[model samples]
Target: MNKQETHHHKGIEIFGKKTELYFAVLCGLFLVIGFLIATFTALPFWFSLSCYLISYFFGGYFISIEAFQKIIKGGFDIDFLMIAAAAGAAYIGSWAEGALLLFLFSLGHALEHYAMNRAKKSIKALGELSPKIALLKKDGKLTEIPITNLKINDIIAVKPNTKIAADGVIIKGSSSLNQAPITGESMPVDKTYIEDIDNLPAFNDIDKKHIVYTGTINGDSSLDVLVLKLSKDSTVSRLIKMVSEIETQKSPTQRITKKFEKYYVPIVIVSVFLLCFTYLIIDENFEQSIYRAITVLVAASPCALAISTPSAVLSGIARAAQKGVLIKGGKALESLGEITTIAFDKTGTLTEGKPKLTNVIPLHNFDEKELVQLILEIESLSNHPLAKAIVKDIKSQYKILVTNKASNVNAIQGKGIEATYQQEKVFIGNIKLMESAEILVDEVTISKMKALLEKGHTVMLIGLKNKIIGLISVMDLPRKMAADTLKRLKEIGIKRMIMLTGDHQNVGDAIAKQIGLTEAKGNLLPEDKVNAIKVLLKRDGKIAMVGDGVNDAPAMALSTVSIAMGAAGSDVALEAADVALMSDKIENLPFVIGLSRASKTIIKQNIFISLAVVFLLVPATIFGLTNIGLAVAFHEGSTIVVVLNALRLLRFKTK
Candidate 1:
């Protein structure tokens, strides 16, 4: 089948399995038929009884069988209590009332199941993003093949508007790509071979412009990509895998409910026995006492309590995922609500991570245009972040064609470039590189470089023939939303916000001031970042560390919570982070925190509602204030109310 057809079939398969709703409707139909036959029609007693029996079995059969199995295993649960209550009603000659209890109980189960499945639709929709087939390039020809057959290093062709079938790097062509499926970014990212290939500093570095991922739509231009990862290991595939595993990692509240179940069932059974004995001694009537005991069992079943946490957590997760925030599990969601402090990595977290040319200072009577042209020519040959920024700026502002560009260009590690431009030897690097070359930089120029550095600009010294000519300053500007996001976080009770960076202390402090951060620790090595996170952990409340996810992995792992920003394109970031922000926008941070706090509130409310119902109803049943029918109505009513309350999270708006 074609990809569209396959997706259609999968959707149909999921909707076809909604058996609980159908079964509940069927049971309700039989109960109505039985009541009408007994009350209105002149039907025989056997016929009416058979209709009631059908309704009872249709609604109560699975419940009774589950209860029986638990009893066989020397266990009792809410199901067993429900079965006992229904059986007691039947014993008291209230067959219609027994059928009603079973019907309502089954209806509650079906509604809860339907609501939870509805919340899971967002995760299930992820499966539809990946295409089933790929356009494989073999021996310079394109052939259609299943995506599953594609392997690492395989070349693939993605046409305009078609979905990319694997994670790969661009070998040829350029296009604007819609990466919303993978990254949740609302904007279409521009990609081109010229910029990526020319400015790439290292082969292993992630060229955001050149890399395309599975499930993302290619723009109006075609692209030839070298597959770096197979279909199974692609970003979208791992996202689906992670979302599928969320249910297995239960929240603390869920674990407590499970433990509470172990003793709760037995306690209810004992309470039933004690109530029956005490009532019989007081009333001296066996039938009335037994009925009251059954009412107490139904009233204290803990159905709403059992569903309270999972329902709220599941809804919260679904809502967050819809907004491009992938919370791994309920534990992470709950932990987010408790985070008191947040730490951010400078580059890629608070800043855009894309440096731009801010200033170009020429020295020694050097022509500014000539120096810019020479720097551009040299930088165009390299792919470092700073080089890319300089080349981009020079190209946009000046028309410099390096037709016969520099030759024997060598990239000096941790410094800059060495090349022979126009037959004159030239060097471009930092002060360290200048010192190594024995170039004389006047104290005036040195002060200028220091002044630029203090303003958070990275300075690159340009030298020609062993003489310092000029210097270019580049800086990665802070993201526009960084300050606003920090303000929102503080408004919501975050105690401290700190920035950690590998840049110099002056640069870090300057950027921190721009972004409203109170403290910043700069010149931090990877290990130093980890030590900072450890020390922060020893202080007051939970700390969350946010970063690009690659270099910050160690420190993030040490923090209470790890968040990865712009994780759609980086597999390393996704793997290292506990929570992945699919897009680059920092504003989503406050939304996630708010959703978590709201979920916690709903969980507490649901638990209180459930427990209060039991506490109030159990005493009423004991004191002859409630009967079997009223107890069943109130008990099932609470379950429905709690489920509906949890469902409110599905409509939660982050904005």
Candidate 2:
């Protein structure tokens, strides 16, 4: 279809959704006119009858359509029961009563559709965030191209105050990017471009991986971003697909209630037929018997029960997404609320995952400045985490440049590294390297190394041949929010919080103490972490494992709930985890758990309200206490209340 024709079709679809409400309102208007003519005006009987007939036509429009469609498929629902009851009432000349019944039922349906569509908008809006057209830069010329036409390594110009069209790194220019849509981060992250073309500043790995995600806003300064991912493979696109699938996953209560409804609908129809037969034997008045039966059938149709759980489940999932938490399904969300033990991985989950140069002590005639220069020169050739820390730290501290850097360096598998500096042999590693190389270390220096280890520092020795020259300490600091987040988890009802890591036991103990964890166990391999979870599972009620790498994936899979730090998470870990904290903020953990608990409470309340209405109306209709109009009003009212209760989750906020 052409653009104008497509718009016309879209307009029709939008109006069709609102037509049910309009027809119901018109039905109520005619019902009032018919009632006034009979009770307050001296009008002809046919005039009132004509008004009621039009009211029924308008009220039954959607209901009749739905009932026939279901019948053609050899199935039935509340719509079928409603249409039969209303037609029977009108057949008995109770035109006003039947018209009122359809009006309320149709209005109930219109309201339900409105509420659900509003809830779905939370996730649907994610697809609209990226710009359809990107300003592509090719051969020094700017061209406007569709985002789908963009290719990997293609450069795009993102202007100030506009959303990025693709995921990329900055090759030229710089800006602060607001990544809230993708990461849920509160502050704007500053990004800079490094144009050494590709080979400069190899030691600073952070800049090499500096990236901007699609749908994030650029600040005042414009940026020239080198595209790293195609539009369809962008992070925002993946999130949209994940959330859309999450909406289809059923909760435990939803499964049970839905299964009950499947068999319940047919049983209700048969039971209504049996009740009418029994009533005819008791009373010779056929009109009253059938009237009572129709009222009871309308009352027990289970409209509210059919919708209570799914509505809450969908709304709960959408609410979590709003806060940047992608819960895979209602099952994971509910399981997180029941957790008693939470095991955290040290790297990237609890700590910063980046080591820092903490201390440097010189010995045997070497000054601190000369020792730092040697360390920087030798580590610049390596890409290890500790080496990067040393290089970064040295560059920030001194401006010394050696005319001849280290040469012929080779790493010893489980020990240290060996190289030639200024025509003399040099070494860097743990004390084992010293023992293997026959280097001498006095008792006083050995005691100092033990003290640094006790303080959670990884101690390394630097020396020339058989003489120790210095002791350097490297440590990975805990995140600033870790202490507060752990304290809050304790205040909330979690019984045990543990730390599991591949670092030494002393390092784990030190970090655990600073973060207020109940216990810390270190030196765990991938399979060992899985075994730890297996042990925790046999003792604890429910447990969660939080991590950000593939090493943590095995243990996460073995836990009651697996949570991944999405911002830095490996693809395997993100897929294996049941929940993704997209912002990598552990503070949101308590909020999501609280949301699940609240969702559970709402689900129970809805079930009770729906079942209570049925129990009340079925018994009352069996006697002479109610009519079709009153029963319809009570039944439809319960459905409206149940839906509105579920919609409350959309506005739920973290405390």
Candidate 3:
């Protein structure tokens, strides 16, 4: 069974496991017994009515009291409307009709309340997925404690196959980390024992020996991590803050709807009073027109209209959350559905941010294995991402030994690293470093490097004695879900998807083509992306920009909607984004788009149905066709119908 049905069943179970059903049967039995006593035993009409009244009170006392309370609060809403209509029917001497209206309205309300509560419960489910406790280490011993109790500089141990309790650095041990829950990037990053000091200079490098963030999962090894931040200090905490902020932004349509309802209800009531008095003045048999006044009031209540839009929006949010997509609120969901085009940042959005060795070019007649060994020996001392990849590549290929006394090893900011290996100058960096060393790259070798760079590969040159010996080309790959998701977007009527990157045009085009992107631009800075989006907006197209690079922030802010890839810990990009992906799975983009569209469709249907009820009911009542029992039925029916329509969002699925 679905969540609503399940929740309804539990509520029914709590009230004697079948209390409503049993009570309904008991009321039916009492009606039959009272009818027999009145007809066959010659009982008084008042005594028979008393028996039926007892049945109604036992079954519907709560609804009657609630309706009365709502009336005193000056909010004569659906409950009060139902009670008034039913009492009016009784005043006209139709007791059975009034009692039946009360029973049906109560049952309809019970079902509607269950549906709405279930949907709200589903939306709040994501906040519960994170673990509450973390194992903190004090005085070399592990202590289990609540995540909220974590403080800065507190060291904690996290094991493989468990969620990281807070945001901090990895102090000890080597393992891969799943960062999808925070950054929306879908990949595992290899982390090592020694902290990369240059990458985290703001915090004391001494304390950042091992750190792990909240919401990431520990990979195949256990490690000790010092909690740098807890709860509100963590990335998830910031995401919650952003989401709450987005929810606070009022939607223009929702505002107008509220204002319309505020004046609409009172005016409708006043008009009904005028209609009743005018009818009484025109005819001497004006008591017959009382039904007309009750009918007009029943038709005019805006309960269905008021509940129509928000109920669907809230239900859609709940549905999106069920699929692991946390859309902040109605405004975000509405904006996301309206996007016409999408712009994507290459690194960490379209392509994997991590660079890997794709090709190795050997110079002269040197042995490839010997050149690789020399490169690994020189690179093993550095902890740059490129350096680590080179070391990993060397370790995977062959076992090699390097002198422990290698000296004068210093890293050049944004250039490369240099070291003296075997008392000879060893240089490894990009093509710029090769020129600075006065190393003349031959035409043939230069042509090969350019070809790789054209294909979006970053080239690292290995030089000795100011002569180029070999080059290692590292290229970023497309994510696993990129192509399939783009195809789905195309299927769903998204006209175009573009990849914007700072890499060479060839590289951007290569990955874009691989991921089904028809439009691709390369070597564009953050400003270029912003201008591109602005130009697109000038043509009246709504755009969604997705990125995980710090440079992509301005463009993200400029787009119609910003989606940030956070799995790689792109905090700056995420902070600038309108929507944060808790999972790196690109497939959710299409899933969420489908969800928004589905919700809009449901909301539109609800509006039409609600308005149709008012139009149909009011006309029928004017012609004296709608009775008190039928009026209450239609009133409660529209409320329940709109509610059910809104709750359909909870069952929404991507596939």
* Winner by lDDT: 2
- Candidate 1 lDDT, 391-419, residue by residue in tens: 88888877666655777777665466788
For candidate 1, list the clashing residue pairs, or say none.
199-383, 200-383, 201-383
Task: Kindly give the number of clashing pairs for every candidate.
Answer: 3, 0, 20
Q: Which stretch of 10 consecutive residues in model 2 shows the poorest summed lDDT?
A: 1-10
For model 2, the local distance difference test gives 0.74
Q: How many backbone clashes does candidate 1 have?
A: 3
Provide the global lDDT of candidate 3 against the true structure: 0.66
Model 3 weakest 10-residue run by lDDT:
1-10
Mark the regions of model 2 whose C-alpha exceeds 4 Å error after superposition.
1-267, 284-291, 383-385, 397-404, 454-456, 525-527
TM-score for each candidate, following the candidate numbering: 0.65, 0.62, 0.61
Worst lDDT run of 10 residues, candidate 1, spans 1-10
lDDT of 1 at 631: 78
lDDT of 3 at 315: 89
Model 3, C-alpha of 339: deviation from truth (Å):
3.4
Candidates by TM-score, descending order: 1, 2, 3
> Distance from true position, residue 604, model 1, in Å?
2.1
lDDT (CA) for every model shown?
0.73, 0.74, 0.66
